[model samples]
Target: MENRSHALMTGFFTITLLIAAVLFGLWFNRDRVERVPYMLATTQPVPGLNPQAAVRYRGLDVGRVSDIDFDPKVTGQILVSLNIDPDTPITRSTFATLGYQGVTGIAFIQLDDEATGSPRLATNSTNPSRIPLRPGLFDQLEKRGKRILAQSEEAATRLNELLSPANQKVILGAFADVSATANAYRALPQQLEPVIARLPALADQAQGTLQSVSALAADATRLTRKLQAPNGPIERISGTVERVGLSLEAVGNGVELEALPHVISLTEDTRASMRALKNTMNNLNERPQSILFGAPGTPPGPGEAGFSAPTK
Candidate 1:
């Protein structure tokens, strides 16, 4: 009975200690501990990307993924729930990116709180958006392989069509026509050999002609300068013009020989008329012809005094 009591006491103490330790641990961790809810939202099982996975806010343990579920209508999209601290107001600008912690490929939820002025997310919202950033290489490779397979199928169909007898004949005919055309053009260079050979000589002749033209242009320029110099044809032409002007002035001022004779005759006729008038006036002055005559038949004869005495 003593041994039994001792054994019972030891077991009781041990059980009590274990319970107290558990209670103390719970009390100590209660403030930091969080409950994460889980839901099957995604059509595909994102294993490591679970609600119980750690939700880091800017590398701090701010929250955890709460649940994941799929909509009844939409395919391939997983609605994820994140349970963040109530005090942590996540805004609309807040982003959630699915990420892997390490090489272990253990996926976790990373909430980007670095975005400024983010609004808080509602808890009752059924649909929560996640940034599509963590598709694995296998997923990308699978999509790429599907696209390549589709392209290969199309190529195979085209190849089959092109390999048909009619297409094959057409391709052969095209090849034959190309070969004939090439054969025809093969002699074109040979036929143009003479023309090609004459090109260099023609170019040389053109250069020579250009040089000769340059020499002739220089000579013409020199001749133009000579003609423009002092005592050239221009100066000679000016001198000739001056001389012609002087000659014209002299001719205009010179006396006319035809009018000289007429002027002389006019002067002689005027002098003669003046002399005749003077002589007539002198004779009239010398002879006083107021004689006493009878009224009907009195005649003034050579002896006018005799008639005067008879009249007296």
Candidate 2:
């Protein structure tokens, strides 16, 4: 009876200890799995990311992707559900991207935060809480690789066409011509020796010429700047012209202009002298010496006929 009691007691104690241990373990891990759900919708390719893949925020492991499926509301859109730590500071500014581990190519969710002060989002009653997903570096590289492959395909086709038999024949003919040209220039070394010998002097002259050109350019730049300065030659010349215009305006306003057509009249005595001179000239042919003297008897004083006494 005593042995039976002891054995029963031993079995009950063992069961209770196991149950207590299990409860303690559950209590210890209670905070470890306090996951908050978040949804991500994207049209971009998310390569190699599977459920249970790690979700990293700023490269630190936070939680894991829980599920991936197409959104029922939006056709052709992928919805990735994540279960992150409740304590994660996933504000409105937080973003998620796909990432790859270096050599393994294992994809994960990489989270980054933008510069915003928005509050942390809570699970919506009507809809799953959503986060935005942008294209990752691997996505960009894959797209660029596709483009490069397409370009390479086109280049390969072009190259095949370019190297066709007929094109190759033409290229060979061109090569032959080039060979003939090269043969023609077989004596070029001897001919070029003199020219090559003078190259140093030519280089020196070129250097000097370039130096002169540089100096000239510097001078031209200086001249241009001097001409363009606010109080430079252009401004001074304009000022001088303005001053001259003002002076001319002042002079024009100060001076008085005279009237036109000032005429002088001949006097009566002068008219009488002219008449006497005309009569002398008329009788000049009759007696040439009368010019030095006067006409006989004062030319009969103006209008009377010449006094000749009594003509015979």
Candidate 3:
């Protein structure tokens, strides 16, 4: 009987000690800060999120998720309840999103305020201020997965078309043409060898022609200067023209003054001689024997000193 009693006492003491230890642990880990309740409603899926998930205010541990359930009032809507510290500065512009802890897939509530000057959100058990739950990175990627897959398929189809047999043949043909062009370029220097060899002679000929042209131009310049000189060809020709003009004037004066009167008097003497010669010719024609006798008697008229009226 004493042994049984001692065993019971030992068990009771052990149980009491365990209970005290648990109580002390609970007291040490208890949260002393006053918290405000908030609700998050979303229609988007919250993967890896559950009750007791940590709630962070801009990366700071501010609270924990208390509950997650479908909204009883709205169909297809989820409601998440959070108990955030009263000093967390939750406001009307504060919002929440689901975030993951690295690659673990563990989700938490990330709280952030869009406007710092927004009015404080007031809440209680009866009605908590609702925060909008926006789609997380994973959720957005999942939603766009189908569209991304469609675009990838389109890109693959285009790549296949580009690598088709016909396109491959065309590409090979273009490479062959490029090789031919390279061969042509390699042979071009040999083809131009003859022309290159003649370049020195051509250069010498061009230099000679240029020198000749330069000499001709210099001669033309000298001739132009001489023509423009005061005592040059132009001046000599002008002086010659003035002297010729004076000589012509002198000849004209002499012709009009001395030569003109002499010519007129000579013309008058010639006229008288012509008249006497004409009379002598008429007398000889009337008496043809007078030419041989060298004489002709004058016949008198009625008014003469030896006036004779001859009978018929």
Ranking by lDDT: 3, 2, 1
* RMSD to truth, every model: 17.2, 18.2, 18.2
Task: Give each model a TM-score.
Answer: 0.43, 0.49, 0.59
Regarding lDDT, does 1 or 3 come out ahead?
Answer: 3
The candidate, 1 or 2, that scores higher on TM-score is 2
lDDT for model 1, on a 0 to 1 scale? 0.71
Residues 137-179 of candidate 2: C-alpha lDDT, one tens digit per residue: 8778889999999999999999999999999999999999999
Better of 1 and 3 by TM-score: 3
* The best candidate in terms of TM-score: 3
lDDT of 3 at 234: 92
Q: For model 1, where is the 10-residue window of minimal lDDT?
A: 35-44
Writing each residue's lDDT as its tens digit, candidate 1 over 1-312 gives: 999999999999999999999999989876575533222244444656765677776687867666667755787866776666656555556655556777887887665655676665454445433433344445567789999999999999999999999999999999999999999999999999999999999999999999999999999999999888999988889999999999988776665656777889999999999999998777566654523331245567766755544453
Q: In model 2, what lDDT does residue 49 have?
A: 91
Model 2 clashing residue pairs (backbone): none
Highest lDDT against the true fold, candidate: 3
lDDT of each: 0.71, 0.87, 0.93
